[model samples]
Target: MIEWLLLLLPVAAASGWLAGKRSAETVNADSHSQLNSAYFAGLNHLLNEQPDKAIDTLLNALKVDSDTVEPYLALGNLFRRRGEVDRAIRVHQNLIERPYLSSSQRGQALLELGLDYMRAGMLDRAESSFLEVLKRRSHIGITLRQLLDLYQQEKNWHQAIAMAQKLHEESGEATESMIAHFYCELAEQHWAQKKAVETTRFIKQALASDWRCVRATLLQSSLAMEKGDYKRAIRCLRQVERQDPDYLPEILKPLSECYQYLEGQDKFFFWLTEASKRHPGCTSLVLARAAYLQQRGEQKEARYFLIEQLRVYPSVEALQQLLALGVPEDIEAASEPWSLIEEVASRLLKAKLNYVCGFCGFGGKYCYWQCPGCKRWGTVKPLAVGT
Candidate 1:
């Protein structure tokens, strides 16, 4: 009832103003009296909590004209904003049906109706209305943007790509990154369906759309590794450092696996050293190098390396690794305190967020090519594990 009253107040004011202005402009005293009577009747219905009748009475009283059309459109938009999508749809639909409306006015009404449909989750109706508005060449940019968002929501990547390109052409906004992510999405879908050829093709298209697309490179690397093409996988994984060094941690395990398959641990060790130097304070890279040294029976060297890294960039992970490696030789007697500290360290590490969305500040334990919070592609990045 209160919601209806809030909606009716504006309509009542607009109707009263229209009645006064039209009465002063013309000597149509009888017409003014009828308008006032209908307005009062709608107000009475609203006060009596009969909102549906009030809406119908108010709408019927406002004859569609240049003066009344704007007020009607405003009322519909207000309904949508207030989450009264059904009412908004009725108002806009009524305006669209009026033959007295100009082309631009009809287009505006149709656009508002489409928004109402979208808000109500009637996506098909929304899409049809937006497309019709596009054909009418009315509100081109906004309609294109709406179409793009609609296709994305439907997971229609092909249509999304097309709409994104059109939006870029219309608005001069750079959409290469967004287009590349859409292509990557298609690649992932095809890969899931075992369509390897289509997957590769879409991945190539993703890279073509945005050469700096780290997700595409990672997908290409995964595909190559699946076929036992370790050298190609190695090349692709190594390319990530150049594309976006923040994702260096992502490539480490894969790159290490590829090198292990090829029996090229020496080459892997050399690259890891260079990468760690280039991207210092990277706990994963530092840890990877330390693990590699420990595997090579260079525990002393690994311990010394971690000590140096911790001196420059303090990290809880590095301290934990150092503790693990520095367990006393007299394990029987010194074990109790060491076990207690290890448990605490393990708990702290598990509680830490491994990845975070740079765009929305959403933290998580796993990596996401698309941020779950903002739904943006390639915004989630591994957190640097150093203070």
Candidate 2:
């Protein structure tokens, strides 16, 4: 690919530089001839669509000069890109073991080796390698980032938070969003272990880190509901609207439960109506409002609301919910409507992915805190109803 060609450019330049420097030496001609032949052979292999062979030949050619670190680094990267982690690790480790390498070169090799270990699923080794690089204060940002990833993979939220803070300090990049997710992870762990106080503490930490973290708000609401504090739960759920309305659908069912428990259906309906006014044609809000209207014995109003919303932004889920309300009591009339609704609902359900990763466009029926495709945290969101 273009990346491979770019990598080879440096190798070619370095080879030329070495040949020029050795022009006065008695062994210069022989060295130049061998190096030039090998370089051209590698280029020929690459052009012939034999990248694997080219990479192997290039690496072998570079191994002849242990003093040349850049070529080894490039070859190691090539191996990593080709998914040959073991070979990449071998190349980097060999470079690191050389006493002739400068401090910076050694550090670079360690970093690459750590990445190789990570790609090979050798997390423990990768962690230790990165820690060694961090101790030398070399490539601070990259080392911290890799450490954060390792901690996340290991589910060690405490370590992840520490590394994230270090990364923020070193790179001057805001890590609060990721730090908030780390707190959320810790909160989930504590909640699962029935450590209520610790869970609450972690959720508070999450909110302190990033007030816009919808996960923290949702967790807080769930915890409040579990404690029989429906008002607090409803209040917490409502915070999500101001924080990020993109996640409003996630709160609807839980909000309904809180209202039903508190006998505040009318208040809930009022809130839904206000939300629909603000976010007109939002499929979830519109559908919820229609359901509330139908429950109030206003079938005509519910049907009218559905028709208006469908005209603006048609949704299979909205249509299905509308049909559920319009079905008649009489057997014959009900049968036809039910059949039609069933077909539409089936099609809608088939098209619906409950969760989608905003980072990588990966869709699934279940939520993932870390995207499976992009390996990013807090990127997956509930799929919009009309989408």
In the order shown, the candidates' Cα RMSDs to the true structure are: 2.2, 5.1
Which segments of model 1 are wrong by more than 4 Å? Answer: 326-344, 385-387
Clashing pairs in 1: none
TM-score of each: 0.93, 0.82
Q: Tens digit of lDDT per residue, candidate 1, span 236-300?
A: 99999899988888899999999999999999999988887787788988999899999999988
- Model 2 per-residue lDDT tens digits across residues 1-387: 666677665765675456545643655677667667778888888678776677566556643343477767887898799897876887788778777777778788999999999999999999999999988888888899999989988989999999999898889989998999999999999899999999999999999999999999999999999999999999999999999787888989999999999999999999998987777767888878888888889998898889788888888777787677745455566476578767878787788888898878999988777789898878888776443
Off by over 4 Å in 2: 1-67, 327-345, 385-387
Model 2 pairs in collision:
none
Per-prediction tally of clashes: 0, 0
> What is the lDDT, from 0 to 100, of the residue 198 in candidate 2?
98
